[model samples]
Target: MSSISIVPTDPQRWPLHVNAGVHHWQYLDLAASTKQPQSVAEKYFLGLLTELPNLPVASNFQDASRNGFRFYQKLQLNDGHWGCAYGGPSFLLAGSVIAMYISETEIPAEWKIEIIQYLSNTVNKDGGWGLHFAGDTTVFATALYYIALRILGLEPTEPLVSKARARLLELGGATAVPQWGKVWLALLNLYSWSAVNPIPPEFWLLPDWVPFHPWRWWVQCRVVYLPVSYLYANKVTKPLNPLLQSLRQEIFTRPFEEIDFNRFRNTTAPTDLKKPLSPLLRAANVLLRFWENYIRPDWLA
Candidate 1:
């Protein structure tokens, strides 16, 4: 098994100067450095835990509160904040890896090791991942994570990769992934953008008073779709490579050439679809399709 160490940044001047109020930690392998954090607070708490004595339960509210503070205070950083591992949503990391792959960014060896470890740990018993670690498996996560691992240099025959591919196929393959998953695969040229429902950049130009204006969308939806609409309008796709070709063959139930991507744009996996597309939304997609075919302006695109 590979070895890793938790490395924390120096913080003597924390909450004051250039390094003030900043607390960061990194996971580095033995080759990078063997040094480990020697935090006084960590040592104190760890020692305390090792030799903790059972005493009569706190008799008063003050004693209980004080004891709780004493235990927790050691966990606080010099920057006057506590740290936590804030992971849950599974798509973000996969999406990031896809982006890096498209940009031809080389992933560090340590990162690749850690990423594989994380995926190995989180994959469901069914041999796929989910929207989160605890959720049921979905094509959206399984497909993207499968692609990410391949991009990280895992062979298709690798045990985990093969297992995930089986799960992806069982879920109706990559074409059954949801809208966002389609966009990501489309970026890598693994899926055709034409199959994707239109996200018109023109919507962003609509007045704020318009009921369905982009600005009227929830903040998360607004920010994400703004750039997504632009990409959709332009139909950006990476130049294909041998790996992409192999992935195309691997991810779909049918031959890549025979798979009608347009047919799958709206064909989300039953496991992944929380709610069916609304009739209004369906009608809008039809109009947008028509516009793309004839009415959409080249300059705007």
Candidate 2:
């Protein structure tokens, strides 16, 4: 069994930042010092559960419709908008946690506990996580989330983490993560940058009208890879420590030093591949790799 509650506080005064139409919410564990109000949704749900102990049984479409709207109305915010947790794409939190860990940022106690609880609760029966809540487990999610739980202070020998480790190794270890996952692991120094195909920043130097110019890419793809290209070009990595060193050994099937990372440069676990690479894309990567090793200039990088 599990429980959750709506965080009730002044969004403006606390950690909610709104600029234009964007909203960034941050959770803080300001125990005792701050007054937390009860949300209308919380009150409504609590009262509803109390009154209908056996649960409400809608006898008709009209009854269900009215009940649904009544519950939804309680969720509307005072700002005239509705907000809910972004519950899809299980990999996003792993990315955020990795970023925080590399930057030495401290997660608030409340958020940290909730993050751990959520990850633990969502683990699949096979002891791994998936791309989304209902999706099957893959190396990408399993490897990243495994590292995240470790960084959050869970012991490697703990049941949840040990199970994930067993599942990750069974799927060919962290080396089996997709290209995007490779970049992230490289950023943390868990995977060698050489194991990743080129994400050359030089691509940005090309004219916007060029057929493969990053500007022509879909906005979401462009925005993500824009910074990644810079990092990849510089071969940026967090300074190594005992924890990272331990992770290196734990996430791999073979000893870290004995593994041939280059062999996995273009490799992705079958479970993690959403789409097969096209012939054109494969040729482009080969050409890019050649340029990276032979022709790319340090000044441009």
C-alpha positional error of residue 119 in candidate 1 after TM-score superposition, expressed in Å: 0.7
Clashing pairs in 2: none
**lDDT (tens digit, per residue) of candidate 2 on 43-75:** 342233323233277999998998887767766
After superposition, which runs of candidate 1 have C-alpha atoms over 4 Å from their true positions? 1-83
lDDT of 1 by residue, 1-301 (tens): 1222323322321121114645333444444433554354544432333233343478899889988876676567677766544467887889879988888887766567667878988999999999999999999999999999888878888888899999999888988889999999999998888889988888877777899998887997899899888888788899988999899899989999988888887888998999999999999899999998898788776
Quote model 2's TM-score: 0.81
Query: Worst ten-residue run, lDDT, model 2?
Result: 1-10
- Whole-model lDDT, model 2: 0.80
Note the residue pairs that clash in candidate 1. Answer: 15-20, 15-21
Worst 10 residues of 1 by lDDT: 9-18
- Judge candidate 1 at residue 88 and give its lDDT: 76
Query: Which parts of model 2 are misplaced by more than 4 Å?
Result: 1-34, 41-80
